[model samples]
Target: MRATLMYSAGDVRVENVPDPVIKHPTDALVRITASCVCGSDLWPYASMKPEDGPARMGHEFIGIVEDTGSEVTTVKRGDLVVAPFAISDNTCEFCREGLHTSCAHAQANFWDGEAEEGGQAEAVRVPLADGTLVKLPVAPDSALIPSLLTLSDVFGTGYHAAVAGGVNERTRVTVIGDGAVGLLGVLSAKRLGAEQIILMGRHQARTDLGREFGATEVVSARGDEGIAQVRELTGGHGTHVVLECVGNMPAYQQATGIVRPGGVISRVGVPQYEEAPIGFGSLFRHNIRLAGGPAPVRAYIEELMPDILNGTIEPGKVFDTTTNLDGVPAGYQDMADRKSLKVLVKN
Candidate 1:
């Protein structure tokens, strides 16, 4: 089988690799049908050094069950399933409480934790099979596959940002970034009934899609200017919630600057920095709340799939490009170079 690996900065390869087999009682072998490149993958694409060569790539995937371990019962061979980016035993205390990302099971982990397996390949070995893979009623060739695939990460992540920020009918929202997650965050906020949605991004194509998703306005400025634009839209009060989807220092600062004194800043973007302002002047004094982390998408998959099935929202539109395993290396480059919002891989 062929799989994607990042050899170093700007170097991604799809090379032949050994096939995966069920290795644990709770494991299942899935033959991947669809997968995609995530914006977070760009962090490593730009800075990964030679020493980190050959890291297995990809996490979000929808596949057909080829085999299952003796203990796996929720799915069977031929079942179409979507695997969340993180591996978890859904019965764990944290998982039961809707925090599947913090599953306490001894074998729980992210796709990268298993060095040999990656979703951007012919197949994958999914751990905690029963808890990690959700069966989809749609067929493998369903038109909804791309939309259904988003349930694995981006869509669920955007939904988490809205839910954690406590978006409601009366809340005003500012979604930072125009990548897949940010665009979907706009969709999620609209779904949650936010009346006013402001999307902060310079990309006209993506922001247009954001408008289709539910953004009432688009702010392309940065720093103080961008902050001023958002404030002006909300009567100089800023929005009730800030969905920081860029995961960069500037995006974080922008969230702080445009969030109302009593509002919340939800960060679904994976933070690139360790130290940030949480002191009186930044968050404490204003009584602003901070929320969001690795979205336990496994917990939200079931709750969010119905809308996709009903065609109420088209989050998969974020995937502006498509390729197969052979083109994944170039797909990574396209995304890193901002030539693609997201790339879908079909195998």
Candidate 2:
């Protein structure tokens, strides 16, 4: 089997690796049909120290079950399924409460020291198979694969942000960032019935997609100027909710500054900073509520699958580039350089 490994910053390689075998009763072995590079993958690609050694990469995939452990009854061999980025035991209290990301026995695919299960590979070992894997009604067509794959991570993540931000028919929402997750945030806001969706993004291509995804307005300005534009659009009141999809200090500041008093800032971006200003003068003075974390993708998969299957949503538009497993490094570079929105790897 061949898999992607990050030796250090700017160094991603697809190399031969050991094939996966089920190691737990709750596990399933999947032959990956499709996978992709995530925006979060770029964080390590840019800053990982040279001495850190290589690490497995990728966490979004849709595949066919090759085999399953004794305890995995929900799916069988030849079943098509989507694996969420995080592995979780659906029986846990948190999972029962719809917070699978915080499940007591949860573990992230690649980040949990499991090299055999990284999505950017020929196959993967999915633990908690009955809970973590969602079976598609039928094997998807090549055209539907990318959309189904997004349910494993990006789309679910953006949906989580919108849900946390309390997007509803009466709310005015502003989404920050225009990456795959951010653009999906626009779609999620629309699905959740937000009255107005304001997207803050600089890229013309992405903002254009944001509009297609239901962004009522696009603000290309940055820093204070961006804040002014959003404020002006909202009649000096700011928006009722802010979805922060870019995990950066400046984006966080923009989110905090443009949300109206009593509004919520739901952030799904992997935070790059150790601390942020959430004190009385920053978020408290305005009575703003901060929410969000790694998305409970498994929890939302079943809920969102119907929309994807029924064509009510088309979040896969984010995947602008497609490549084979060997082309993953270039896919990573394309996304890191902002030359592509997202890359789909067809194995």
Predicted model with the maximum lDDT: 1
Instruction: List the candidate 1 regions with Cα displacement exceeding 4 Å.
Output: none
Segments in model 2 whose C-alpha atoms lie over 4 Å from true places: 106-113
Q: What is candidate 2's lDDT per residue for 1-347, written digit by digit as tens?
A: 99999999999999998889888888899999999999999998999887885888889988899999998999999999998888887878988999988788745333335655589999988988988888888664556788899998999999999998899999999999999999999999999999799999999999999999999999999889999999999999899999999999999999988999999999999998989999997799989999999999888888898898888888999999999999999999999999999999998
Model 2 residue 48 lDDT score: 86
Query: All candidates' TM-scores?
Result: 0.99, 0.97
Reference-based lDDT, each prediction: 0.95, 0.90
How would you encode candidate 1's per-residue C-alpha lDDT over 1-347 as one tens digit per residue? 88899999999999889899889989999999999999999999999999988899999999999999999999999999999999999999999999999999998898866788889999999989999999999999999999999999999999999999999999999999999999999999999999999999999999999999999999999999999999999999899999999999999999999999899999999999999998998999989999999999999998899999999888899999999999998899899889999999999
What TM-score does model 1 achieve against the real structure?
0.99
**Model number with the top TM-score:** 1
TM-score computed on alpha carbons, candidate 2: 0.97
Residue 283, model 2: Cα distance from true site in angstroms: 0.5
